[model samples]
Structures are given as C-alpha cells and as structure tokens.
Target: MTVQPGRRLLLIGSGWGAESLSRQLREQTNPWQVTACSGRQANPTSGADLLLWLLQEAIEPNALDHELGLWRQQWPQTPLLLVLPAQHRYKRQWLLERSVEGLLDQPAADAIAEALEVLAAGGRVIELQPETTSQHQRRGQGLGHRLLCSGVDQIERELEQINAVLQLAPIHPLQRFVLEGRRRELRMAREVLHLLWGQEPIPQAQASAPAEPLQIVLANRKGLTVLHTVEERLAHAVASLDEAQPSPLLALEALLPDRRRQLFEALLLEFRLLVERLQADPTVASSLWSGQQPLLRERALQQLVGAYTQLPKEGALVHLGDALVSSSDLQQEDPELADLLPSLLALIEGRPLLIDGGLQAPDEPAALLHLQRLVSNWLIRNGELISRELLNNCSGWPELRRAVLLPDLLATRQLDQLRNRINSAERWHTLVERPLAIYESRRLLFDIQAGRVEPTMVCDLRDAELRQLSWWQQAFTLLLEARDALAPQVELLINRVGGLMVLLLTRVVGRAIGLVGRGVMQGLGQGLQNAPSSGDQRS
Candidate 1:
C-alpha cells in the first residue's frame, strides 16, 4: 500500500539512529518527510507547521517535565511516545496520563512505521500492534540490527584488548567505570565507523585515554536475572576463600580493599540516612543536592555546557556567595549564616544542612541526588523557601536555596559592581571555551568517583590547554578577518621577493643558452655547410 504523499513524522533520537531511520524511510516509495526536529538540539518551533511530532523521550525524569513543558509550549498538540523497556518503571503517572502515547521496546524496525501510522490517525493516544510478519521483521531489523550483529565481532576484539589491560590493575576500582565508558564509546564509535567514519572523535579526548574507567558490575549487569547478582558472586568467592582460610584481610587487600571499603561504608551510611529521612517525611529531599562536587565532576560539566548552555547548579550557588559578602539582605527574623547560629543550620559548599553524621561525605551520585530537590525548590524559585515552606519552616536544604538564589543576585550585582569587584584572570577562567574540555573534566571527576579516572592524573593544565585552544581559534578568526586590511602590503612584499629571484635566475639561464647556441653554430660551419650571411662583411 502507498503511504500518504507527504505526511509529517517527527523523530527525536540520536544522530546515528535518526540517520539510519531516515535512510530506510527515503527508500520507501511514499511520503515520509520530517515536519520538524525532535531531539534535544532542535527547538519545537523550528519546523512546526505540520502540527505533529513523534518525539523520543531522551531526557531524565525531573528534567523531562521541563523539556517537554517547553516542547508543549511550541507544538501544543504534538504527541510524545516514550521509548524504554516495558519492564523499566517510571512513577510520573501525572505526566504519563497527559502527554505520552506509550512505550516502544528497545529496538524493532517496523516500530518507526507503526509510529507514522499512529501520527496519521491524529495525535491521540493509540496502541500499535507489533508486526509479526517475517517481512515486517526483515524491514525493521534492516540496517541497525545487521550492523549490531556484524559490529559485535569488532567490539569483542577491542573488549579483549581492554580486558588484558585491566588484568594488570586489579586494585583499580574506577577501572570498572572507565571500561564501561570505553564499551559505551566502542558502541558509539562503532555506529560512526560503520556509518560516518570520516568524522573523528575529539582529538584531545582520544589522546587522553578516557581519563577514567568504565563501570562494569559483574553481578548487576543489565539483562541479567536476580539469580545473577553481585551477592551471589561474592558468596561463591567467599565460600572458596572460607575453605582455603587464607588471611581474610589479604583477600580484601588484593581486590581494592582501602578506598573500596570507605566508599562502601559511605554509600551504606548515606542510603540508611536517606531511607530514615524519607521515611520520616517523603518530601524531604535535600540529600539530593551535591556540595563537594558539581554534576558528574566539573570537567564533564564544562564539556556539556557551552555559552548558551547555562548551569542551574551554578545559578543556585551564585547568590549564596553574594549573601556571604553582604549584610543588608538579612532581616531581623531572617538571619544570615554565621558562627552564632547552631551548627545544625550550617551550610556546606552551596548546600544547606542538618549537620549531623547523616549528611557527611557520600558517593557522588547519591550526594548529587540529595541536591535535586534543593535545586528544583531553591534554584527554580530563586532560593525562595519552597520544600522548606511546603514541609513547614524546617531547615532541610537552606544551602541549595541560597545557591540558586545567588545566580540572579550575582547577575544583579555584576551589573552594578562591575568596576568594584571583578578579577580579569578569574573572569577569563570562568569563561573558558572548548565545551568538550569542560565535559571531559566532569567525566574525569565522575570517573574518579567510579574508580575509572585517577584524581592525580586529572590536571588543571588540560583545562588550560583547551582554554588556550579556544583563545587561539578566536584570535585566528580575527586575524583572518584583518586580512583585507593587510592584503596590499602582503601582495607587494611577495612581488618584490619574486622579482629579485627572477632577475638572478634570468642572467644564469641567458648565459647558458648563448653558450650552447655559439657551440652549435661553430660545429655546423666547421663541418663545411657554409651559408651566406645577411651581414656579409662581418660573416
């Protein structure tokens, strides 16, 4: 059956996936032109005339609402169908009921075609039947499945090489994170090498050897059942050890005993505190905001954000910095943080506190999770008492409140205090270019946490190198533009240099040719082929 002549189908997946889908669609005899872009990169209004979008849910849950909220504002009637495992659960039912069409399983080719059919029926929620026909299966599994199946051969080869390297570093806990990253990179790289091999991985990152480890767990590997768990692996290992009765500490020492034990203790302690705090009142989520480190380490954050991509976390913390420097903002009832106040009301980094052992050092992911509510409530609302207000005047996340509140305060103060309180070096430092460098830095921190990236190996100089490259690019662009002003002088200098060289060369060439011609003339006359000359007397 011929599909509609020019029906719109919005796709919001990664570039490679989109390209593969587009190629398959183009081969089809009927209409399948995209009405607009659907991924994180393209805004909704970019091509909204079609009034329909088949968007993929590429964002996280908390951020999803905000991203979708913006999408709805542009294409109000456009429909979204989330793609995830049917087993993967999300509790955002309020959002699901309103916006989502349904879930699409991990992969399957006819799914794209089915989505098109649903879009044709109008943007209402509809269930799509899985095409069991072998033909449909063939169509669905065309390029991606074939590529995945074939590429597995190459990935296995690379994985083997990595496993060999990892064997030498058994104590490296973060090696797991780095390996996981490499495997992910291998997946992403395979997609490119198979499809767009011309495009290269960022040079600096490639040279740096990932700066971290990929987190691969033996027990809780995805696609495994409950029976295949870390506990089970440990149980078997422990049983073997129990029979041998080797030094218990020696075994621990052999397999990342020091930092591993500390991290485990921190995680266990934090999780316990999280459960207790949440159990007391489910709304208290201050534990989510990270203070010791920003999102996924600062380097990765830098890479991910560009001039346009602002950090809400930074926006949250800016005002707190200002409040510390000022006293006028504090009212009689509302006091600024100081030594006079109880330590329970203390602020750590940019996060507010309950200041007991529960809020002590924790793993990066869990620590950051503790800050989310602090961000939503504090940063989103300009540090106005939100979750605190919601749960009565409890001092749960005052630090986050202050942090988000500060960006605006800083913005306001920057304009007024530009001359009074700014440092040139610091300004340039903050305004570093080369976004991927920032992202790498963040990845480094994340890797460090995961036991992939070494903290000592993560040099501040790498950030400087990226920043210098950014400056040089800008400077070179300016140089190129100034070419018009210097063109006449440059051209004149080239001509002068060429003219001198030409004059010297001409003298040597003229002398050699004259010598050769005279020799030839004498040789012919001496051989008795004498001819009359025009200048007879001289001849």
Candidate 2:
C-alpha cells in the first residue's frame, strides 16, 4: 500500500493488526508509502525507511530466527519496530541484539502510528506498561539492579586506579583526563541511584592503583640522523674494542678503513668551513651550540657521517662549495680550496683536523646528554615531591623520569624515519599558528631535533608559553612564600606605622619639633655669616 511518494515503510508479519498498522501509517502527514508482507515471505526490498514486524502470534523458533537474520542482512539500515504479545516481552534483549528500534507492549493502532513517526524521525520508543510484581519478579528486578550497580562500581574503581597513575605521569594524557571525568559522572549517577532507592550510602571506593607511571618521549629528526650515523659508528668502535682486546690501534684501524677515512676527512673539511660560516653569524651559532661545545662537536661529527652517507665521494665537495659560495666570481676565485687546503693536508696524514679546528670532541650526543642533566635535576628536586603525592611508601619512578626525557634522544635517533612526516614548511607554520601553542612548540622542536629542518631554522619558530609557564611557576612560588611570610605581621606592621605617623602629626609633638628646628636654623644662619664668601677668597 502506498500512502505518499516520500519515505517507504515495510510491514512484515501474519497479523490482523498488520492491516491496522498499515492504515494508521497512511494517516501520517509526512509523505510515506507502505508495503505489507507476511512473516513467511518477509524479504528486504528497496528504499524502505522503516520496518514494522507485527507478530500477533508467536512463530516457530527456527523459522523466526532465520527470517529475522535475513532481514538484518538485507535491510540493516532500516529501523525495525517489533509488535508482539506480552509473553514475548522476555525477547526484549533478543530484539535489541537484532537492532530493533521500538518494542510496543500492546499493538494498538494509535501507538503503532506514533512509533512509526518516531522511528522515521530517528527516535526510539520502548513503551512497556508497569505491572504489579510477585515476589519472584521483585527478586529478579533486584538482581538486575545489583548487577548494574556492580558493573558501574567496577568501572569507577578501574578509573580511579588509572587516575592514580596519571597523577604521577610525567606526560599529560587527554584520554586519562577524559576517563577521570567519566569516573566522576559515574559516581554522580551512583549517588542519584542511591537517593532514588532510599538505600544506605554506597560502599567506600576500594580501588587502589600502584605507583607505576608510564612515560614515552617523542624523537626529532636531527637527533635520529645523529644516532643512526654517529651512534652506530660509536657502537661499532666499542664492539670492536671489546673483541680486539688490548689492541686499541688494531680496533681503530679495523673500524676506520681507507674509504671511510677519506669520507671522514672530507666531512671534517666541510665542517670547518661550516663553522666559519656559523661563526660569521654568531647569533645563530651561539643558540645552536647552546654553550655546550662538546655536544655541538658531537653533533657536527654525526652530521659529518650523514654527509658522507648521502654524498660518499670527494665530488660532493662541489655541492658544498656551491652551497657556500653562489657568486661566479667567488667560485672562479676558488676561495674554498684555499680555505680548506690546510684542514685537508692535516687530515691526509690521519691527524684529524677537527682537533686543530675544535670540531671533534669525544662526548655523548648533545640531546641525550642534555636530557640526562635535566632528568637528574628533576629527580633531585621534584622527584621526591611527586613520589609523596603518588605513594606514601615509594620514592618515585626513576625509570619513568628517564623515559619521559628520552624523546629528545629518541627523536635524534629516529630522524630518518620521521623526515617525511613533518617536513613541510607550511605544516610547520600551521602548527606554530595553532591555539595549542605549547604542544605545537614541542612538536616543532621535535621536528628540528629530528633533522627534518635545519637547526638554524629552529630559531624562527618561537612560542613563549613554555618559557612563560616556567617563569610564572617560579614567580608564583616566590609570591606564595612572600605572602605567607608577611601574612601574620601585615596588620600589626600597618597599624604601628600608622600610629607613629599620627603621633608625629599631633600638636605637642609639632611644638617640640618646631622649637628644636628653629634653634638649628638659627645656628645654620650664624655659621653661614661666619664662613668666607667666594668673592672674598678670590680678592
């Protein structure tokens, strides 16, 4: 049956009520068309917006399951309204599993019409009549209620445990924060449930989370490149040293083959030249080195290895020359050749020119070294404080603190892996302009450390929030101390100062002070008269 030219409604079942449902559906003012089919012949057809399954009588089990499964498979998007007997009310869970939209307790013509309209408008209706319960029914309802409360309480406990860990977590997790909020909401729900049932207060929350905070640091590109190139070489050298046993020269010789030596030497020459360029731009050089010269030297050495891996030949010098000196006149003059010749000559005989030029320094990668210092300091200061907050017995998670700082080192190690991920200039700018400036700042710093961009480029991306936050923390701490120190004496100090000023303003004090002041003024005038004038001295 067609009612209107808009949404289509499919009615399936063998029932006299199916005819009633169909007629009622036709009364909808919204455009709708209806199709009536028997439960035995219930098959999905095109463009059905809603399905009404009216079962006036129970069907055979195997056939009913098969037909429902078939409808589900075919018209999964269509909302289904089940109209069945009171006995079938137990089938509520079964119908829900099948994605039934509405369950009408009694198949009334008016109710079916309203349900269809509600389903059409994307609302669900489950209208079940309240009935007087026997002792068994009451027991069953109480069991369900207890089960629900148990599940909710368990979830709250779990969330509480997670929040305990998060309290000590070095990195702030949005997911954990959201879970904490949900736990509070669940607690409120349980309180409401208690109030509604007029029961005793809910049992105390017994969930206890262990003090095991997890931490992970994000790696940057330059640090990764350094790790891959220089760190690998150091690992090889160390391994070779261990194997060669008492023959350090043999290990050194084994590790530094002639081809690798040449590459190293060429790289040293480029580094020396690069240093000259950086020195000329002192501002850029100072920030890049960050006054940690040993770390800077290590970075340069790592970049040297990267340069060799990429270029691998002496001809790469041509590219380096072009990068440094673009003018034809300067190129013709071959100033690079003149400048690098001394470093090249020194390196030819295995006297690493870096020693002379101050580029080669034996040290840990700067990023990791810097991180170690930061972590160590944090442990000494905030570690105990956080430990107190996290657990009464335990001190702190020293391992987790190190892990938190590992991102700087990890980013350096993973530079090559993330080069393509955060390499766009436009992407960098977009991140800078984002409202979460502090997070974006860290992300961009990771990119720089990863070697996705020039270390020099790091100077351009500036967000003062993290720095400001640090300053604010210090200032706030000092302000709190000052307020506390002055808090008790503040009123007394003000009153005493006010009382002294008031006494000075009184008539008796003024008269006594005036007499003394007049005598002093008269003495000063007499002294001036006795003193020699400039004119008399000159004459």
Candidate 3:
C-alpha cells in the first residue's frame, strides 16, 4: 500500500513490537512516514518532525538520561514523545525538564495516535492515563536489567566515596544536602536493582488496607512499608514510624528528626488553638473585614500609606543617623526611635527610587553613596512587620513580590506620606516598575522556552540574582551618565571605585552560578529517588 505523505516520525526501538507499531501507523487513515530503528543503529535517512523513543521497562535511570541526551543532541529541534512502561512514570518531570514533549506509558497504538495528534498541534501530553489492571511481575534477564545492575553498582561506589570524604572533612551545610540527596538516589536504585533480580525483601503478610488512607505503599522491607504521601499527610503521621531497624534507606529522613518532630507538634498545637479561638469568637473573621478578601492592594492602601507618613520632611535626612546611635532607639519602646520614628537614614538606597515620572536619585549627593547601607539598617529593625504584611497580601509572580517590590515598598511605600506632609516632595509610587518588570521577566522566560534564549543563560542565576544583575547594570549606566557632571579629578576617582565595585559584584555572579550548579546536581539525585520499578510490588 502506498501510504499518503503525512507527519514524519522517527520511531527508535526494535523487534516484533516495533513492527507492530509501524503496521498500526500505516493502517491509520492519516498515515505517517515512519522510520523504525534499534537504538544501536543510525538515525533515519531524512530529518524527522518528531521522535518516538520506546524505552524498555527495565532501563536504568542513568542510562535513560544518557539516551535522552543523545536524542536531544541529534534532533535538537524535533520534539520527542517517550513511549515508556508504567514503572517509569516517576521520570515524567525529569524528562519534561529536558524538553521531552509527550509520554505514553504502556501505550496502545490508539494512545500513540492521540499523543501524536497533540504533539502535531503543539500541545504536550505528559502521561496517558492507562486502564486500571493488575500488573504482573515482569520476568526477564534482558539488557535493561544488566544496565540497571551496573547503574546501582556505580551509585553504590559514589556513596562510599562521599562517606569517605565526609569522615575526613566536615561537609559544608549545602554540600550535606547534596550528599544526602545522592544517598536517597543510591538507595532507590538499589531497591530497583533488587526488584529486577527477584531479590527484593519479602513481606510476611500484606495489609488489607494501607495504614494511612492517603499513602501508596510501594514495598514492604523488614516490616516497614516504604510509602509515598502528600505534604499534608506527612504532617499528620510523625508518630507513625514503626521502630524499623536502621538502614541506609532512611538516611534523608535522619536529618532534622528532632526538629521535624518539634515542628509537627508546634503546628498541631497551633491548629488546635486556632480552632478553639474560632469557636470562642465565631464572628471575629467577619468583624475583622466582613470576609472581603484581605488582598494586598487593600492592605497596601491602608497600612502602606500610614507607614510612609512617618518619614521626616525637612532638611538633614542624613543627620538622622547620629540620632539613631543606639539599636534600641529603632524599637517601639525606645524614645529615640519614636522621635525619629521611621529612620530616614535606613530607607534611602543608592538605586534610583521610583516616583510618578521615572527613577530619581536622592536630592542629597551624600545619600547616593550610602543609599543601600541606610536601607539595610532600617530594614534590619522594621522589616519583619513590613515583609509579613506584603507577603500575606499579594499574589502572582512571587519572586517579583519578594525580591523587588518588598524592598521597593520598604523604601518608598511611605513616600506618599512624606508627599502629603510637605506638598513639595514627590509621591513615591507603589509597584511603579512592578507591572513592567513582571511582563519583561515573563517575556524572558517565554524567549527561553521558544529557544531564542538558552536555558543555560538563567540556569546559573536564580530570579533574585537576575533581578540584581539588571538593577546593577542600570545603576552603573546611570552613574556613568552623571560622570560628566563631576570635576575631572572626581570623575577619575568615581571610575576607579566603580570598576572595583563591578569586580566585587562579578564574584557574586560566580557564587550564584556555583549555587545553581549544586542545586541542579541535587535535583538530578532527587529525580532518581522513589522511581517505581519491578521491585515495587503491592499486595
């Protein structure tokens, strides 16, 4: 049969299974140009629109990652649809992060057809829901099982290496998180290896029901059922641990055992108190605000205006520093803090403050040099309350809220108050650049997704780091503009100091990159943890 030209698919797999799939594709009313291959062989003669990677059930996590990487390199523009076993469903997010388009778990030809349709339309099919049926334990001594065993061996070696290093030198706090995360991956991989070999620890008796209704028990080992539950359920089940003998499986859980218990207790107590309080005053919520949602804008409109009103209007905003000689003066109880209430010394930071028109440098030249320092000290005293209010009130773009606006609000939310007191002062606008910032940030993210900007561009910089970089870049440019205003000697001095500052800032950028690298490593380990394998049998 001469199948009509249609969407080209490169189906990478082998055997009778591949033949059956190809036959199904040919039989479809909208036939596709299918090229099937054993992964060991070369790719198709022509470039494909899409890739269908049919990974075997028992493929090791590490091996799967390598194969995916190769496919991505080979077909950078082509979207990949992974046809995987039900056991490998846990890898969906890991695959998605690497730009895999769709996942069809234990797919029928119809499921494959549906997934392809979605892909053709530029939509994603993360995982096709399979019909509920009994899963029989697979039996085989296949290549995948061998690879699994090898992967487990590699993980075990890595664990030993980490343990040896830890014994010799105290690991940094950040490094410890990475180490423990790796340990979890090793244990999970070991479990999968045992399951593949039919050597998993057997449970004496199966429970009629999972102990926790919300929990999904994967395996029962040495009288302890390794289960998965949501964050909320984890909170209620702190005391449910069954005194199982110590093993490497619980290494991640070992950290903060005491702190976790204390936290659980505290939360439980707080909930009880809240319930009792609600019972006592059934009308408190109504009396508070009549259930008109405590939106950030409303809170900002009220408290934000009130807070800003306390800043001094007249001369010597700088001299307020001398009056705030003692830390206690900033506190409510101190007379000095009350007299110089919202310390002007604290809020002014060198970065241009947003107002009605555009960015404004401080009126006083001295204020420019120590703007950030002043703001930092003020926030040190009164920041917690301001932060709590803003956090509780806002929605959307949490990074923008926390990093940019929180400081903006801290510095200038009260500027309107200063304007009201003295008509000459310009009103500090709340969320002036916020709307624009949100749009630009989202646009940048979109560009990354569209492949215009590489993910690597922001991979090293967290949202805060990116925002800070943008701010510094603008600040440096603004300072350069002011260079012409100063005397030649002053301009030279400024140039030298500015260059030194830029060099120091580059160190921060390097640190952010290193932090991101560590985080990526931790995430890689985390993804490998809790993968459902043949060993994960439930009665």
Best by lDDT: 3
Candidate 2, run of 10 with poorest lDDT: 446-455
Superior by TM-score: candidate 1 or candidate 3: 3
Quote the lDDT for 89 in model 1: 31
For model 3, the run of ten residues with the poorest summed lDDT = 446-455
The 10-residue segment of model 1 with minimum total lDDT is 334-343
Top candidate on TM-score is 3
lDDT of 1 by residue, 1-539 (tens): 34454365566554566667766765676657653354444534444323333344434666766766766776666555555433233332333233544344444556656655554554222332222213333345546555654566678799788778767746477877788789788877776765742332233334443322111112211211111222232223222321111221121222222222332233323333433443354333344422211221222212212213322333353332223213222121211101111211121122233322355321122222223222211111111111112111112333332322223323433323422222342244344422333424421221112222112222222344435455655465455557866998899999999998887778877778888999999998777656655698586
Q: Give the alpha-carbon lDDT of every model.
A: 0.38, 0.44, 0.45
Score candidate 2 by lDDT. 0.44
Per-residue lDDT of candidate 3, residues 274-315 (tens digit): 334444554463342223222222332233223333323233
For model 2 the local lDDT of residue 102 reads 71
lDDT of candidate 1 at residue 34, scale 0 to 100: 57
lDDT of 3 at 187: 84
Ranking by lDDT: 3, 2, 1
Every candidate's CA RMSD: 23.0, 33.4, 29.3
Better of 2 and 3 by TM-score: 3
